[model samples]
Target chain A: MKNAKPSSRRNFLLTAGLGTAGVAAAVATATRGEKPRAAMPGATEGSGYRLSEHVQKYYKTTKV
Target chain B: MARMKFICDAERCIECNGCVTACKSEHEVPWGVNRRRLVTVNDGVPGERSISVSCMHCSDAPCMAVCPVDCFYKTDEGIVLHDKDLCIGCGYCFYACPFGAPQFPQAGAFGLRGKMDKCTYCSGGPEENHSAEEFRKYGRNRLAEGKLPACAEMCSTKALLAGDAEVITKIYKTRVVTRGKGEEIWGWSMAYGGSDKLSDLPGGKA
Candidate 1:
């Protein structure tokens, strides 16, 4: 019936809205549980401490 | 590579507060913040000792460990620095620090505390090296300028030595050997993870 088609369309929309919300909630939860990475300059991985050439030379000068 | 470190010779320190003044001037630190200070033990006593105190840039910093936002990071030279942008001014780092290094600006109204500030070991923050933004947030980047910390450099008695850990250790050992006493280095063991007594160092007992 024509009335049944309208009800089915509403049901489809409701299902799609719920699905979208479920995905959003899932993503939010994942983001909350994730550990935030440190904002380090010139570091790609790990805790940003690196012994570059300049530091190495400075060390040589500090030697007794 | 060498890990940055500081060694304050209590025997030589005159409690002049020169290190504190130098640090404040070099950084233009605000009124309420003292990045470096002199701690005197046994005040008014026969043999009181004064030691320059600041952020030790610990091998394993407690502030970094307890930061809820994970804003603290260590540089290649082992300087512990924090990002002011990420800091919440929660005073958690203040409680976690053993040296009392974390300082919050108290100029806000309604008892509001500002972002935590502390000694950066003459090394700037995550901003560009020597940039105005970096100086505004973290003070001078003397380390990046191929120089040592101002506090140590300005010590009149050369009581405060700052540089690579291995080198300073050697320098301290020589001093202990020459003086023939005062082997204890306050906060060295706690900060650097070793025996605080310089007698433990090689040639320190001589």
Candidate 2:
């Protein structure tokens, strides 16, 4: 019983460390974003080249 | 309005000259003039790299700065195009352009330098968008048709990318990080196509 409590505390600390690392890993993945999308605002106005079909094409092609 | 820009990933480029051919076919550029080109480094070596090159449409364009006739103009979309009608064929742009984007058509036996022509970012010139006059003088205004430059679109490996500066840079950054290696200077590679790769192509330089 004398060493039992200390080992249990150590085990708790290890689990907490692993949990923190898991949370950090999840946060990092979430921030990285799921799909790579670019901001090309006002891409359809003025010129004859509207974003219509080509924008779709770009989406499929520029995959990271 | 989205500011247009071009980016090429040298690591993926195989020096196929596909971009160069696509540009010529799109613009019908004269026999002697090339709006785009490819430069390779380390031919027949281990680290050979190739890149597509053309007008970068810089934020501070040297061509626009040096032109005496003020023919050069930057579009609302940040495309730097020139008015051939106003150009004096002075060749100042050829010298001023860091990428050698300015090109002259050798139209005569006397080595005559015709009107200065360069990559318009496929946005045409000062003329009305999608106009016939615009096509004859500046080639097709694909941008007016809501498209990126043909060279970028036609790139085989998708090494060349064209679109808004923010978008392309973001995409390129994503690729550099995802691929996890090979440093990329996107615009610089296309602008200069650095000559330091170790080529491994068969039968020497292709």
Candidate 3:
């Protein structure tokens, strides 16, 4: 009975290890195929601040 | 970090329509669909002024807000883009745009509306950058190529400036100060006069 428990535990560990390897391979393949966004010249040269509503309000104030 | 922007000095614009032509030619924009154009306030008048108009890429874009399909997305550079594949040709964006930037091309035997088209700030759409799919739907992705919008770069008078906002604003401010800003704008009154008093305009605590 003790030997049976040990074998089942080993089997569980083996299944878990294989499942993890399969997930890692899938992630690597997906990442390789996906094209990530590249930085633009403007973004590289200057502060790439998001143009939010507060900025628009500030721009309205500066309109001469 | 360049905050991409475009500013056209009315005093320098001669109504040449050069900017319009540049944008059209660069993108191969279809017939009857203009992504950029010159708006002259008082043509023929001595002190008349003109400004090139297009999508300003507003911080709070109404088109983005109103798109029922939720196709619009803003890039890190503040360029507004949309996925043509997701667009349903419902024309909600056309009505929502304050600049009249959204355009529709007539299609099919029934004359149905094609997908929505707009300036894109020359940054193209959500498609892979500079891909044929992007070009066929949204025209060129010049910004990704490290180039300014064709309209501003090709302006003959140097009136239309496009770059990081701070740089262009500085250039515009210097010109205005050095040249002695004019006291009277010929068509400003005609084009923008509704009421002199604030109370006359439609305003109340809804």
Write model 2 residue lDDT over A1-64, tens digit each, in one string: 8999999999999999999999999998785543222224545366634456775587469763
Q: How many residue pairs clash (N, CA or C atoms closer than 3 angstroms) in each of the candidate models, in the order given?
A: 0, 13, 4
True contacts kept of 3: 0.06
lDDT of 3 by residue, B67-175 (tens): 9999999877777888989999888888888888888876556647888888888777877775566677888776665566778767777788776676566555555
Instruction: Judging by DockQ against the true structure, name the best candidate.
Output: 2
Please give the RMSD to the true structure for each candidate, in Å.
12.7, 25.4, 13.3
Per residue, candidate 1 scores C-alpha lDDT tens digits across B148-191 of 78888788787888887766776766676577655455765654
For model 1, the docking class works out as incorrect
Model 1 C-alpha lDDT per residue in residues A1-64, reported as the tens digit of each score? 8699999999999999999999999998776544222223443333222354544554454333
- Give the range of the ten consecutive residues with the poorest summed lDDT in model 2 chain B: B196-205
* Candidate 1 positional error at B116, Å: 0.8
Ten residues in sequence with the least summed lDDT for candidate 2 chain A: A33-42
- Candidates 1 and 2 compared: the better one by DockQ is 2
Once fitted onto the true fold, the runs of candidate 3 whose alpha carbons sit more than 4 angstroms away are A1-64, B107-111, B182-206
lDDT of each: 0.79, 0.77, 0.71
How does the DockQ of candidate 1 come out?
0.03
Q: Could you list the iRMS of every candidate?
A: 10.4, 13.6, 10.0
Residue B79 miss distance in model 1 (angstroms): 0.8
